[model samples]
Target chain A: MTATTLETDLAGLVAQASEGAVTPAQALAEPHSLGLLGLTSLGFLRLIHAVERRYGVALDLDDDVSYLDTIGSLAAHLRERGV
Target chain B: MPTVAVRGAPGAAAPLTWGQYAIWAAIGRTAPNDHYFNLTRVLTPPDRCRPLDPDTALDRIGTALSRHPALRTRIVPAGTAPGRAPAGTDRSAVPPGSAVQQEIVAEADVAVRTVAAADEATAGSAATDLVEELAATAFDYGTEAPVRVGLVLVDGAVARVVLALCHLATDGHGADILLRDLRLALLGRTGPPPGDPGTVVAEETSAAGRDRSDGVVDTWRDAYRALPPSMFPTPRAEPQPVRWWVGRLTSPALGLAAAALAARHRTSVSSVLLAATAAMVSADGAGDRAAVLTIVGNRFDPSRRDLVATLSQEGLFTLDTSAADFADLLRPAWRESLRAYRSGYYDQLALDAALAQVSAERGEQVHPMCCFNDMRLVDLPPGPAPTAEQVRAARAATVFTWAAPQPLVGCRFCAHVTAAGPALTYQVTGDTRYLPPQRLRAFALGLEELVVAAVAGPAPLAALPARLGGAAA
Candidate 1:
């Protein structure tokens, strides 16, 4: 899968993980959402798991999921880590 | 009384392992004014299943509880001389746990009191017969610190399970784990099979095996000590009312929405849920000044995996929503959540004390003047999932009963998120006169909506769009 599709699909999954209907584009555009930078610990795990599945790679122990503290960070990390 | 046992049949000073201790310490930090996390539930024919023989089931439960050290442990500060009575105390509490010997259960770690025929409809007009039977059944259950296993038989079947643990012993997750284990024991299932996550790891055995990790209890103290002791959930109410409610989102859509929100916010379903709940609670004029209580399980510590361990700390985050726009409120809410994350270390004692004092003068529940607990956050893997109907019925019948009235301040809501689905249950008990049953349910529902709307949009737009449930409305 192209890096763009991976980000798109993975970002889509994170959006689904939340409750309201949120477009990934608006989420990307919003700063208020920055606070949501931290999901519940378990949700955090699932997000990581989703990224792993989308790209067909276990999160590199080196990738540091916690470092994806923000949506921007998560997308960038996924881009670099998406095999 | 030789501490060691002669042979088998339950005995050991199995201390709380790193994971168990971490969790209990966490529980001790986030508990309410009273040492009661009284999470009682009415077991249906399904829940009541145990060895056909009642005696066998009791023994089995006893034996099962006996195996876990955390269940037997209690929390006493780390250096306090055992039984030497710390200041203003006469109890020689053996730390946060106590051992269980199979001697008719002098005290139950958790009592399983039975009240046969509590299934309401089937249990018609049998109050006289049932009450008489319950009185007889009650005798079989112990009433000491660690409650003995007490299961009631209604019309010949196991009915209500009363698990009253010293709040210091278990948290919501621990209670769930204990119940599932009890289910296994009743079935032909042998002791936790290898890899049964519920199987108590050696490290988690408490000092007597309850959750006697008093030292671990101080994690939140340090976490909160770092913060300014600010009053929270402003306009704190006293005689804090408490109530319990059970509600399930009832749609695969909720799960999907969660995934979508998570992807958009770059957070988890829980954050979405919490942010939503927080918004709902704050929606009324109440959101303008109140700070809801949240207990974040800080199993973040690497050495622990008792994710089931109920250890959690209290976070008294101040959410100032007096901003001009939706984003204004959302950004600060986000910042507050992040601050809470940074100071996730919770102190149950502090939380309880804060609630106690908060309730002492105001008219609101202190611990969570209104809780927005997300149980799905725990992540129970999907097994043969129960039908939504079964899960819903079980939750509906049991949620209201979990409320331990009076002496508690706020009404608390916990959302247990399972892969099968998310179940939201609230436990409230305070003043029945002030907040009646109808009002309690209404408050819970309102609170649920507020949290979601808040997280879905920004300032001046706290409400979700019409397409998304009209959050603004």
Candidate 2:
């Protein structure tokens, strides 16, 4: 998928995972930190599950979790995994 | 005793969901005293709400049961796989074979025992007794539904409704949902029913589900290998007559101090309490590394959020308390807590196999028989930090006492944090052989002192043992 499309999809997933508490615009604007966008621990887990379901790629939570600190980093990691 | 017949839409038999399997394993371990797993709630309608007649209450309960199939579900041995068990077979005595499945019945009879009381005050006392009586017996999982309902009638109207639910049917969160639904049903409100358990079973059996279980097993293996052989390695005192004793510390000061620490550190109150407990565990000579089996409510998925099922499982939480100050431990505790909760959802059989493998590798059993359960549904944002004087004043109202003795639990050290009116209550039930009543009392007090001390200023980690009245580190 294209970069823009992937990010758009990711934003939607983030919004859904947060139960609409984090809007797509807010997710896009706060690309550096999803936590800053008000995503809770449960919401983070849901977002990971959504990403796995969408791309058939599992995010290794035990590894360095820095990539998960931001939407941009997560999108890059997914693409590097050939998503 | 009178029985109320509840009829619901029946579901085909399927393998027990992962959540059900987890509780099933615990039930097996807890056996005859399995009633300990029963979740009981005595709910009295608010005074503003209309008083409900016994017949109306029963009707509302039946409606609620019909809406949630999990309330009508039963676990049976695999021998009775395709259908219900034979009418007269002893369901509890039947040993489960290689597999077990849960079945939802179209209709089941629930016992409704009514206790007549003269006034509301009398009814309140009767309700408490009814809860104990209704929850004291284990459910026959193979034949009987997993719910018992009791009504306390005062002046020909229902004053309180008591529900005793088997752990196989639901956990604390699910019980809350069921109670909410019951209230709504009583008020004649209607909405779409919660998700079904069969769907959960199907999802759990899928390929992705297997992969998730594999990942969880891997996490468990790593945690087991790192944890000490046991959290409580040595017995400090002789075993009590009851083998276990429960100690409770009810303190508004602890709650205020913990909230202050949580706010200052930008962490959660659960993490603050966990850090304090770990400090005590380390000071008590368990080791610098504290391992606790934390209960995880696996309702992150929206689909399972309101599902009335036992979706809770244990997750491994380990913390290294080599830090210089107590404040430094909060962030790591919060991060590790998140990881532990994430690893909680998995197949119990797979986890068992993993534990066996780890135990064999270590040449001994590898289990952290210490647990921590934060029972609050939501951790509201903490207000501004309370001043030291305010916290000290609140400390004057703290109460620490020994509750009733309990039968042997599965764990040696179990700590539970629950809300008690305006204050917070910490109950530490431990094996007396490992933790004597004195030590249990110290542990509870130390939990309060640690947080309160931290709120006042930086509490030195090394001084915790001395402050807690334990041997110096």
Q: Which candidate number has the best lDDT?
A: 2
- Predicted model with the maximum DockQ: 2
Model 1, A3-26: lDDT tens digits are 566556756766644322345664
Error of 2 at B15 (Å): 2.2
Estimate, for each residue in B336-398, the C-alpha lDDT of model 1 and write its tens digit: 554454343423344446445545545543343444445454322222223334333343332
TM-score of each: 0.52, 0.89
Candidate 2 lDDT (Cα, 0 to 1): 0.80
Model 1 scores a TM of 0.52
Error of 1 at B110 (Å): 8.1
RMSD of candidate 1 to the truth, in angstroms, is 11.1
The weakest ten consecutive residues by lDDT in model 2 chain A span A31-40
Supply candidate 1's per-residue lDDT for B417: 39
> On residues B14-45, what C-alpha lDDT tens digit does candidate 2 reach at each position?
77777778777777777766787899988886
Please list the residue runs of candidate 2 whose C-alpha ends up more than 4 Å from where it truly belongs after superposition: A1-83, B46-49, B95-99, B385-389, B467-469
Chain A (candidate 1) TM-score to true chain A:
0.58
